[model samples]
Target chain A: MSTPTHEMWTARLRGAWQRNLPIEKLLPDDQPAYVVSWIYVFGVATIAALGVIIASGVVLAFQGPAWYHTSDIGNFTNSMHFWSVQMFFAFMVIHLWGKFWMAAWRGNRVRTWITGAVAFVVSIATAFTGYLVQTNFDSQWISFEAKDGFNSMGVGAWFTVTNLGQMLLLHVAFLPLILGVLTLVHVLMVRRRGVVPPIDAVPGNMEVHK
Target chain B: MTGWLASFLDHPATYLKWGWFQISISNLIVILIMLALFAAAILIKFPKGRE
Candidate 1:
């Protein structure tokens, strides 16, 4: 007499899920009272900005750079993508710095910090590839200027930004795919860790006596 | 005033060079904005013992 394989696997998954993210922690409507500070809001704002950025970028991806640079509707979507990236970077930088100052890695939350840092670094690469694929004077100049430095480091052959086709594929596909994965990991870690409390916050102190 | 600040922040021609580092006005603006945001977040406090 043996347990069914399906049941065994299901039981293991259930155990892991329970150990990692119990339902109450995952969907708590009530937050700890110290969570009242406005700084906590920046993380949500950053996530929102990234959502818009990816949405606009996807729309832009359906059209080539020439179309976006020339046609009205394409131009509108391009502007949306441009501004969304700007907002994304702005919000992300603020959130990253805020978390750093808060020492957000406290109480075994180190994975959260590392994931966020990974997301930030990947975002820089994605943004640089984005600029290179812009099909404008700025892109040409940047590619030309950057090539020499890359050549000095002996990476120019692999990452030649001057090659529009290669750059477009990287900007539209590879880098964004990596960014999406990094963001997913970052979000899952945040969910698992819950939010970090302030430096002096007592573990079981539910409320502050005002 | 708005135009002046915009120009000050985005004067791409205004470049500064150091040992192996080069930056323009727009880059400076970004750095300043990030620092200001960081400082502002740090200055905001939660209630005592609330962490």
Candidate 2:
């Protein structure tokens, strides 16, 4: 007897998924002892700050620019969004510095490192779009100042910073979506590959004194 | 509060300029604080426990 088409496809997908990343590795309960450093905390801290940024941004979006400029509550939420972004960048850069020094791609974890680096680049673009959509004098000044740079690179044809509508849509939708997906992939790769062990902790290496 | 503290808090931002570089005092302070925090994170001892 032949298996049903749907069952066969489902079985193939399940086998591939399980072979690549089992459930335990995906949602690990423990980590290597080397991960017990304060430096490791910065990655989770960055994610936490991103959560605050998204929550505050959602509140700001509901109220709109005029409300945020006038209402005290709206102003408070805007501040939250702004400060959370500051925290996010601060933590992410610190985490990146720690990872670089640690040679975080030491094992077969090169994809994890690359995804993180790509996410950092994407975040800068996301933040730039955010600045363009602020609907304030600062935004106007920045857009005017940045226009020539974009034009010089030939990106201004499609990405006109002075166009508030386009900038706002990119900031509020496209860039955030891309950043979120990049972050998710980076984290999953970290989980699947496992955290890179310390350089000196490798067994049977006789290059230096203990 | 003290006079200097009040002045620093209430007055417009102070800026430092040298050649082509200029930065507001508030921004400089925040940058310094971030540096300090990074150093502290590296130096501080983290507690270890079994998972």
Candidate 3:
């Protein structure tokens, strides 16, 4: 006899956890030797850049645009935020390119690949909103320039860059929250699936339950 | 440290005086950053053969 829906769902969840996320898999000391490659570094570097971006962003959010643009500490924090965002995109693109060439979607890891792509798109939107909230010549100039693109796409009014409050809200709250959640899900999927096996190792070698 | 590094990325000039338009340091910074990222990506390499 089949169990009730709730009970069956609970059992399935437990089974999934045990099979995919045993303690060792979630926090592993031993990864496959194939992971000993410099290409892998970019993924971790991207995450590190994101940490800096979030930290500096929180500092900027605490102090308003006036303070951030004028005060020394605020300027420093804002620059940190800016440069970290540079690093974030740099590393993310490299990681994305490396994974793409490796065909990272293979080995039953399509969700992992899709989640990463979603996170990338969300992050780009977050960065675009950041540009709009800078409260400088850049913001005004970009707002006007960006207007043409959005107007062409029929989203000019919906995403008006000149709407400072709207831009700020999306930058400091909505976009970051969405990016953060997507990133977390991407990492969780990575942990669940483990890194995809090296292309050479996939042919005849036994697949380790890493 | 991030601030220190960003100092090197300081505005090279105030504005670019063009025939029809003036491009400010902010605009220039975006271009410079993209160039820097492209350069950095080229410099950081993965090994040619599989490990």
Number of the predicted model whose TM-score against the real structure is largest:
2
Residues B3-31, model 1: lDDT tens digits: 78777656546878898998986679888
Q: lDDT of each model, Cα atoms only?
A: 0.81, 0.87, 0.83
Q: Candidate 2, clashing residue pairs?
A: none
Candidate 1 local lDDT, A1-210, one digit each (tens): 999876798888998989998887676666767677767777888888888888888877777777898998988888888888887888888887778877999878898899889889988888888888888898999999988988999998998878989988887788888888888877777778877888888778856333
Quote model 1's TM-score: 0.82
Stretches of candidate 3 off by over 4 Å are A1-12, A202-210, B1-51
Tell me the TM-score for chain B of model 1: 0.54
Instruction: Provide the RMSD of all predictions against the true structure, rounded to 1 decimal.
Output: 4.2, 4.6, 6.0
DockQ-derived CAPRI band for the predicted complex in model 1: acceptable
Q: B1-51 in candidate 2: lDDT tens per residue?
A: 368887768777889999999999889988898778888888999875653
Which portions of model 1 show Cα errors greater than 4 Å? A1-3, A6-10, A208-210, B1-12, B16-23, B42-51
Q: Estimated TM-score per prediction? A: 0.82, 0.86, 0.76
Model no. 1, DockQ: 0.31
lDDT of 3 by residue, A48-132 (tens): 9999999889888888789998888988899899999988997898788778878999978999899899999989889998999
lDDT winner between candidates 1 and 2: 2
In model 1, what is the error at residue A113, expressed in angstroms? 1.0
**What ordering of candidates by TM-score runs from best to worst?**
2, 1, 3
Q: DockQ, in order, for the candidates?
A: 0.31, 0.38, 0.15
